[model samples]
Target chain A: MTAVLALLEFAPGTGATTGFRLVDPAQPHLTVTDLAATRGDGIFETARVVDGRVQALEAHLERLAQSARMLELPAPTLPLWRDAINAVAVALAAAGVADGSIKFVLTRGIEGGQVPTGWVLGLPSPDFTRERAEGIRIVLLDRGYRHDVAHTSPWLLAGAKTLSYAVNRAVLREAARRGADDALFVSSDGYLLEGAVSSLLLRVGSRLVTPRVDIGILAGTTQADVFNWAELQGFTTGYELLTPGDLATADAAWLVSSVRHAAPVRAVDGVERPIDAELTARINAALDGRID
Target chain B: MTAVLALLEFAPGTGATTGFRLVDPAQPHLTVTDLAATRGDGIFETARVVDGRVQALEAHLERLAQSARMLELPAPTLPLWRDAINAVAVALAAAGVADGSIKFVLTRGIEGGQVPTGWVLGLPSPDFTRERAEGIRIVLLDRGYRHDVAHTSPWLLAGAKTLSYAVNRAVLREAARRGADDALFVSSDGYLLEGAVSSLLLRVGSRLVTPRVDIGILAGTTQADVFNWAELQGFTTGYELLTPGDLATADAAWLVSSVRHAAPVRAVDGVERPIDAELTARINAALDGRID
Candidate 1:
């Protein structure tokens, strides 16, 4: 089997979790009326799994709950999700898949239906060895929102990692059209934001910096783990409101995600930039080591 | 059956239409990895059907093609779509449904797979007598983008009717929380944008106006029909850059959509506003009259 699928059932009215059922990942599971399929009305979290353990498990669950709160979906049951996640990770490990990802999604359910649809799907992670080794070429695109949109307009659903990622996909395609590997979104008002599917991390000498979490971006779980690991390695870490100038001046930069770990940004908008190859390899080693 | 579903199959490489298969709408037809469900990476067009004819069908198809161009999806074979759409509309009409909607969707297929996924679904329209006659209360929400985003950053997918509607759903929830029926969005730069799922039409005395299509809003098919019909009735029509202050001063206003037609705005942010009951009824009657 290439993937494992678990579906969650919710109790009526109280938003309490009833139970979960593991289903065939190959077969059809979602109806057309599912809000996730129709309106992109859902929240999701992807956690990397290694050696039968889900890395950054708590952080992923916490972020999922935070996203659920933002989208006003039923709050996810943490223990239930953690157990289901572990079950999927265990399945992957049993299949001899050393590295994979478990993506858990909680949608507002069928249109007008009372029950919400929740699922955890585990799939072997594709090899990102090249991206992690040689690094990635990136371009900065406008995110079409101000940096403070999360606070100024909560209804915009900024900072909430919802499934409405069409713009995110568009940016990646745009980057490809521009002959780049990935795209880092810059706010419309000239502040550095995050990547389409990852968080922007910068290294200046021994100090590591990432955009402030309060900005309109996801609080990246993997980035958080990298920061923790870097701190233990005698490096300082911080959250700051960064700009393109800061990124250009940094000693090294990366677009970090759970499955991909740390991918150094080797170029910006076709212009070659310095990459910390040794540090990137170390970060990936630490991520694969399952420090949690 | 409550709904009709037609799944479209495309020829390899050329994006030519091979055929369409009518399927069970109740069954799961899409994979878990379809880009539409995963990333909201799709475009859709919903047209109202009356007496076996889809209103503004050509306009909807053109807009769908336009959206496909913007999103870089396979250009929908227009005639195939027309036939499929008509077939679904005919199915609805044969089922004794006089009033209904045909929503056609074209998605980028399963992740990384070639050939797109296309579907046409026809469902009975909900009763909107209260919203049309009694009118709806509305609140203005910030859309989190400047009015010029479509031109400045086309990758934001602003003008395209993409499946990424989480924010659209969020704004409505916010409106309901504020004791309103609908939400109209304003650009972050203080210019008027469109509504969450409808187009805003205003009447400044003898003039009918809507926000310019170039200002990152959909070129509303229903509003276009309304304008053409109003011109026949000797009302001058135009597109202009507008603001909340302009909305405040308009003699009458409406939130018009494919399914609901023209719904007058009776209140704004809990404050009662003037609604042209006579004009609203006439407009709705004209719409139902199948002016096309």
Candidate 2:
């Protein structure tokens, strides 16, 4: 098998998911009416796999459950999902892949069916060496929402890792057209938000700062891991209502995600920015060395 | 078949889509990796089918092409799509369904496969008699975007009929929780926008008004048809930047869509609003009496 796939099966009567079954990754297992395919009405999380073990498994699952709650989907069985994720990770490792990523999805299910559709896909990871080491150039794009929207308009599904990411992908393309590797979304009212697919981490001297999570941004799993690593290394970690000026004045910055670990932001909107290579390497090392 | 399904096939060598092939609607056809299933990276258009003929056929096709352009998908061969849509509509008609609706989707395709995945699904229309004559209760929800977001941030894809509609679905749930039958989205700056799955149409005396299309709202196809019918009947029509005050002030209001036709707004945000029963019936009749 080129990749590992697991379909999470739920017991209709009791509303308890039994577990997952492995499937051929190449086969089509989704119907057209599945909300995940038709309306992007679902939630998902991707975690990196290393040495046959999933990294930050609990964190990813926690975020998945948070997203489910936001989307009003059935709460996923964490222990069962944890087992399934590990199984997919182990399967990829058995296939002799050193590094892989597994993405687990929980959808609203077939339209009108009410029973949720869920899956875990495991595939060998792409070489993100260039992104992790040399760093990524980012362009700031308007997210078109206020930073406080998550509190005011929860129906907008802000801060939820839902399947409706067409805008997220579109901004990346826009960033590329503007000669950047990635895009950081700035709230409409002028606040630094988050990356299109990752979380923004800034180093301002001895303090490690991320945009306040209340500002309608995902609570980044990798960013939290880095914060834990930073704390042990005697750095102060905090979240703040950051602005573009904060990004410009910060000593260094990076976009952190589960799959990519930590990618330093070398430039913003075409201007070269400082990269904390030593701290970056240490952060990645701590993340990569995770035994969980 | 309970429903009609048609999958479009593209000629890879020539970069031309030759035609479409019928498929069993019940079978699972979409792979997990398809961008539509993962990222909601797609566009769609729903059209009403009456007596085997698609209402506002050219209008729907034009909107589909317009959405493809906004999403940067390959320009669909409209004639091929037109034929497929008509075939699906005809098949559903042949199945003894008097009033059916067709939803055509164009996705960015499977991850890394530049080819687009497209299909037309035809299903019998739901009974909207209660919604049409009795009218619907609406709640105003903040859409979390400035009215000019479409012009300011095209990446956000306001005005495009994208499949990334989790928010669209979420707001309806919010509306339901508020004991309303439907929801009308308002811009962050408090300007009235459109419905979750339909367009807002207001009757101010004899003239018809819809939210200006430039403010990141879908230009309603049925609303356009109604305008044509209105002009023929000696009523003037226009587009304007409206507000909640407008909804309260208009002589009558309706959330117009393809499948549901004209659903009069008898209430807004728990407050009873005026309903022009005579005009509402005439408009629905005009929409239903379409020859094409």
* DockQ top scorer: 2
Which stretches of model 2 miss by more than 4 angstroms?
A: A13-15, B13-15
TM-score of chain A of each: 0.98, 0.98
**Per-residue lDDT of candidate 2, residues B74-104 (tens digit):** 8889999999999998999999988989999
Q: In order, what fnat does every candidate score? A: 0.85, 0.92
Clashes of 2: 0
**Candidate 1 C-alpha lDDT tens digits along A1-292:** 4788888878988667778888888787887777887889898888888877999899989999999899888889899988888998998889898888899988887777877888898999999999999999999999988999999899888899888999999998899999999999999888998999899999998999999988888998889989989999999999999999999999999999999999999999888998999999999999899745
Best by lDDT: 2
Best TM-score among the predictions, by candidate number: 2
- For candidate 2, write residues A88-203 as lDDT tens digits: 98889999988999999999888878688999999888999888899999999999999989998999989999999999999999999999999999999899998988999999
Docking quality (DockQ) of candidate 1: 0.84
TM-score per candidate, chains pooled? 0.98, 0.99
